[model samples]
Target: MLLKGKTAIVTGASRGIGKAIALGLAREGAQVVLAARSAVSREGGLEGSIQETAASVEALGGQALPVQCDVTQEESVQAMVQAALAAFGTVDILVNNAGVAFFYPITETPLKRWETVLRVNLTGAFLCARAVLPAMIARKKGSIINISSLAADERDAGTVPTGVAYGVAKAGLDRFTYGLAVEVGQFNIAVNGLKPKEPVDTEGMRFWTKPEERQGWVSADKMVKCALFLAAQDASGVTGTVSTDEELSLWHGL
Candidate 1:
């Protein structure tokens, strides 16, 4: 039980990577808060919900709280954190895994779509991190894992299927991980970014990728395991890094 007696908040926990991480933490004995825009799965996506995830956690013998959060809204994010604190006392881990992406050429991409991606992917992480830092700093221990993308590092021109906003936001997230890690290191809080070395077979990925392209994708379990590795580490053990699943697994011998 690597995370026994700990409490964790996982954003966008209705489905995909976020849901997997929530369940994984619970299996390791961490009480979990599942936060997302809805308690039920949205139309036209895979089946999942905050309530469902919470139930899964409870079934694993861990406490669970389901919180409705629109990460793009600071008020919503704050309310979600308050709800978590009311239920769990203090947060030991925060997984900033809520995100959105739409693939389009710059000229073809709508401004609203571009802005929405940035708001959810980058600004949301900022708000959640701010909300948890006070308690974590006071406790002198915490782990923040920012979900990032390999698209942030891809430089081959005109090859990427993802929109510019997605890449830019993830790159910004990586920078945030680095800067925040340095700032909070003195308080013994660890911050880092983690992304799949290969794409995960997530609902979002299914929608965005070609059917044939999905064949080589990794399972959601891989993301969950990688997140566990990050969450279980102490500040001295890991911080201020942006790494892929493969990189982390090799480094930690997972």
Candidate 2:
């Protein structure tokens, strides 16, 4: 019950890591606002929706609000936050988990694809953080966790595969976390980036990896404990840095 009485907004909450975190928050007593690109399951790819996530949250006896949000669009992000505020009074946590990736080579990648990566992975976090900061500052208590990746570091070059935009976007996101944490500390707002220590068995990862080969990948649920710790943070506690799941887990003794 670490998050009792809190209201959290989780973007990209239709499935995978986002969905897992949303449910984890709800279990901890937060009324979660599930934000995703679609209300219903998309026709292709992985099959889950904000509606499904909302249903699960409510099933766990927590209040839920499902919002269709295009994180890349300012208006959409604004509307989503307003919906949360209208329903819950205040936002106590924000999880920037929405993202997109293009794995082809830079030479083969289209301009639109490159822009899309930046918009969703980097700019989307920027927009959502901007939208929620006013409320957090007013309360002088809030946590903003950016779901980042190992690709942010140059040592993880293999993670880039054939493309580069995804890594570039994540790196920018890390910098954003650091800078924002420093700026918002005066208001007691905590901002930090969290990432999986190993490959996660998310829908996208399962698609890219062979079934047998996926045994080593961690489950998306493994992130919840780390996320839970971050969700409880403020300027006085951990903030301003990017941490792996292992780091936060050990730090919190989970």
Candidate 3:
């Protein structure tokens, strides 16, 4: 078990890549804190829920704590962090996987929608990182994985862009990952940004694109593997990286 005796706090863990990462960590003997806004997939995006995810983690013989968290709110993030600490003693890992994407041109995008995307994707990461750093620094060891996206770059002809706001937000997150890594490296915390090389076949992706358009999409398992690799890194290794799934697989020889 690469993560034996570790405790991880995963945001947006109710479904999709976040849920898969939480399950994968649990299977590797990590206690997991499942944080998300909904207990279930009440918003009609995916199938899993915080309750269901926690139960699955326990079924894998790992501890699990389900907390309803709105990462966009600072108090909510702080409370979630406290809940994790209360449940598992301390957090050894934090996966900033909570995010929202809007796929529209700037001309059609509403100011509120753009702001919402940035708030959830960028500011939320900052809040969660801030909330977890004290515990991690005190322990002098930890990992922070920021879930970035290929959408950080402008898309080409074969793909659709994830909107200007999402791209900008993820770009900001990547910068945050690097800057945070530098600042926290002295405390033995590894911070890195991970982007999917290919689109994962997530429910949200399915809702956005047609079946035929996503024929070559990767499975959530690949992302889980990549996340596991990052989370398992020692404090002295692989900090301040912005890597893709394929890149991580190659580097870690997965």
Candidate 2: residue 162 lDDT (0-100)? 27
**Residue 77, model 1, lDDT:** 91
TM agreement with the true structure for every prediction: 0.96, 0.96, 0.96
Score residue 248 of candidate 3 by CA lDDT.
89
Clashing pairs in 3: none
Question: Can you write out model 1's per-residue Cα lDDT over 47-103, one digit (the tens) per residue?
Answer: 788998888888878889999999999999999999988888999999999999878
The segments of candidate 1 whose C-alpha lies over 4 angstroms from its true place after superposition are: 157-160
Local distance difference test values of all predictions, in order? 0.89, 0.90, 0.90
Write one digit per residue (lDDT tens) for candidate 2, span 125-192. 99999999999999999999999988778554463252588889999999999999999999999999
lDDT (tens digit, per residue) of candidate 3 on 1-254: 99999999999998889989999999999999999998876754567789988888888888899999999999999999999998888999999999888888899999999999999999999999999999999999999999998888766633755688899999999999989999999999999899888888886787778777887788888789989988986469989999998998898898
State residue 85's C-alpha deviation in candidate 1, in Å.
0.7
The TM-score of predicted model 2 comes to 0.96
